[model samples]
Target: MFPTIGDLISYIFHVNAKVNLQTFGSCMALAFAGAYVVFVAEFKRKENDGTISIVKVKTASKTMEVIVNACIGFLIGYKVVAILLALWQGQDPVALLFSLRGNWIAGGGLAFVWGIWAYSTHKAMASQFIHPYQLMPYIVFMVAVWGFIGAKLFDAVEHFQELLYNPVTVLFSRSGFTYYGGLIFGALTYLYIGYRHKIKLIHMADIGSPGMMLAYGIGRIGCQLSGDGDWGIVNRHIKPGWIPQWAWAYTYPHNAINAGVFKQGYYELPAGVYPTPLYEAVLCILLFLGMWMVRKRLRVPGAMFFLYLVLNGVERYYIEILRVTPKYTLFQLSQAQMIALLFMAGGVAGFVWLTGRSYFSSTKQIP
Candidate 1:
């Protein structure tokens, strides 16, 4: 249901071998390094140009100002976030925060990093605080929160059977992150960020639409490279009228889903179901092309945004048929299918509203 990037990395490097901490640590370090480089480059572009300005904290008082701002941010974020989680799951605030030993450390680290970054950036951009670019902080914050919370909630839902045995463990586990879950929530979170920024919601949506799809594809590549459990089923021989064995056939040694025939505590799926994530990633790239084109051609408010919703919904609904997931009811509908339907409705409604506006009354456009 959930896979960590570490699993794929381990499998790639040494199939049927243990994944050691040192190995994982090295990979994480590399990832962080690459991320920092990109962050710095973007920050500099904003800094060097007139888009954003940064001034050094020259005095002790200014330093304290930064520190206080950072602290206030952390408290506000933690308190509100904790309360929301508690409300959602009917749990104690303290219990939710400390459910996993790593939760406190990870959450605190995220808060600290974003808090300090926002404080410093805000101060630097203070002179132009009201500029349109001021929306970056909210966007970044939305991405982080949506990704983290969505992943957690999806995991909780996916493993409801396991949760029946130990609800607390299921809710708190650090291991239950689904990449697509995070992606979906992150996109929804952008709506609020858009409203706050005073950008027309659909305009803001168009800005991120292409990037969002591409970024998700990148994340899937991470899932594949890490060999987290996102892999498809395995089959010994090629299915009739399908791709040849040599082209698509590959063994996933010691995969938990496919390792039942291997030994105790290890499992593997029977070969050749579908490399669904890979297929999804490829389709996402193509979908991104459509989004980019529509954003360029469609000037109507919300048109590109609606296009994204419809296209993404259609893609996910079709892909769900090939993936292994818990189905609800006798109809065997998947969780993603439910979300896809919602997206499709939103898209259709938006398209209808935008195109049917009074401004276009003089020229009747064909459907």
Candidate 2:
């Protein structure tokens, strides 16, 4: 299991670049980038078909631009000049970069320049038409921030003991995130943002659902690559002749979590566990493709999103059977399974409601 880019590169090319980049974080970056592309294209397609209504959003107003851009400029100018000064003085630039050392004049000048440029840009675009997709960047940024917070908070709940032992470590750790928490929190944030922008809830959900599927698929690939302990219970079943053995089960040697028994300067599971992350990655990617293909055909407002929930719930519920998670003794089900069932039930009800609504409305319109 390769935890970092440096590790993977060393194994393949036998060279030490010593890159500190994390595999999971890099994959998440790619996931967001891919999602952004999907949003851009999906919104444009909806706009062209007259399905999306353009609203006058005040996000790019002169005051907003000036304030945000000035802060950005100040930070950039502060650290950059400090680093340059340190290098000239034969001191450690990296150390200075993190310190309070900075050139105030340079920072102030850049801040003014940045603010003026942003204000001018907004003023120039005042008369031109704006697309509804202009809100995508802000939506994505908010979702990413709050989603991470939610993921961490839920993880802390599940591992309360660990958090108590080392509060800072557990809270800030890059791993140990719960996906469902992020989904719930991010969805709430997305809804609020959509409301602020006057976007229809159903339309927003439909546009984002497929991209989210793709992002999740890509993220699971990271979990598998890093072996961050999201694997399944031990697999006793023999591998079929047609399938790759590692895909069926893996010992997860040198995992990012450094789990399993250590022996002879190595760490690995005594026996193989089912590679559930890989399974999820494959399933979600395929499902994303299917969703993308079927999206245009779904005439009902929220049908596409409801379909997403059903598909997501079904896949996760079945996979939870193989996964290693704490279970509720009463129901003999993991928390994820319970949530999955809710998603599936909600999806079915939503589909029924929306279909009935459209049918009744159309019937009433018929003279």
Candidate 3:
């Protein structure tokens, strides 16, 4: 496994080309990009089928647009200018960009330029109409932000003692994510935003299901590729006749976390662990395909979403058994396991109730 894109490139081309691109981060980004495409497709289909209608909204003032762009520019300029300077000096990026040091002058200049450009683009427009799919980019951005925040918050809770010892380090570190936390928070954020857009809860839920599942599946590929410690318990079992050993168990060489003792430049686990992330990626992608295939057939408003929940819940619950997660004494279940059960229960209840109603009746009524 390659920890970073730099490492991957080094291996592939036999060069010491140093790039700052992180494997997990890159894949996480890819996950969102792929999901965005899926979402666009799903939304277009719904629009074509007349399941949803176009939305009309007032545009913001040119001044407001400039302010927003300027703010974004300032942040980007701050980091990017510093990064470029570091590259010029051949300094350690981890030490440079990760620190508070930045060129404020560059940031201010960039912000000014960005604001002017935005002002130029923003002519007087009272309102505009758009398909709900146009909002998916912003929706994806919100999910990434809130999902990351939620994951960090949950991780903090899980390691309260450690957090107390080093609050800044634990809070700011790029690793230590809890997918369930992200899922819950992201779902809430999506629903809330969709509601604000006047999209029906049922339709919102239905539209988000396939894309969300696909994103998770793709994101898990990052976990597998980077070996970010989402693996299962040690596997020392004898090899099966038909199964490949690498598939059954992996030592996770060149792992990102540097968990095991380092004999050489790179890290490697002493023993093999079940590649749970790979398993999840495989299962979820398959599930996503199956769900996507039958989504049209499930005419019930929330039926597709409920099916996603049930299948995802069940998969996580079983995978938790094989995983090495922190468990609560209550029923000896992990936090994720408890959440999984809740999801399963809620999914079943919601699925049955929604499916009982006639989709035709719901379709005729606007949200």
Per-structure clash totals for the candidates: 20, 0, 0
| 51-108 per-residue lDDT for model 1 (tens digits) | 3344222223456656766665566565656645554554434344444322344346
Per-residue lDDT of candidate 2, residues 248-289 (tens digit): 889998887879999776578888999999999999999999
Which lDDT value does model 3 have at 4? 71
For lDDT, the strongest prediction is: 3
TM-score of 1: 0.64
Local accuracy of candidate 3 as per-residue lDDT tens digits, 301-348? 888988988999999999999888888878999888898898899899
Per-candidate TM vs. native? 0.64, 0.85, 0.91
Preferred candidate (lDDT higher): 1 or 3: 3
- Between candidates 1 and 3, the one scoring higher on TM-score is 3
Q: What is the C-alpha RMSD of each candidate to the true structure, in Å?
A: 9.2, 4.6, 3.5
Computed on alpha carbons, the lDDT of every model, listed in order, comes to 0.58, 0.85, 0.86
For model 1, the local distance difference test gives: 0.58
lDDT of 2: 0.85
Can you list the residue pairs that collide in candidate 2?
A: none
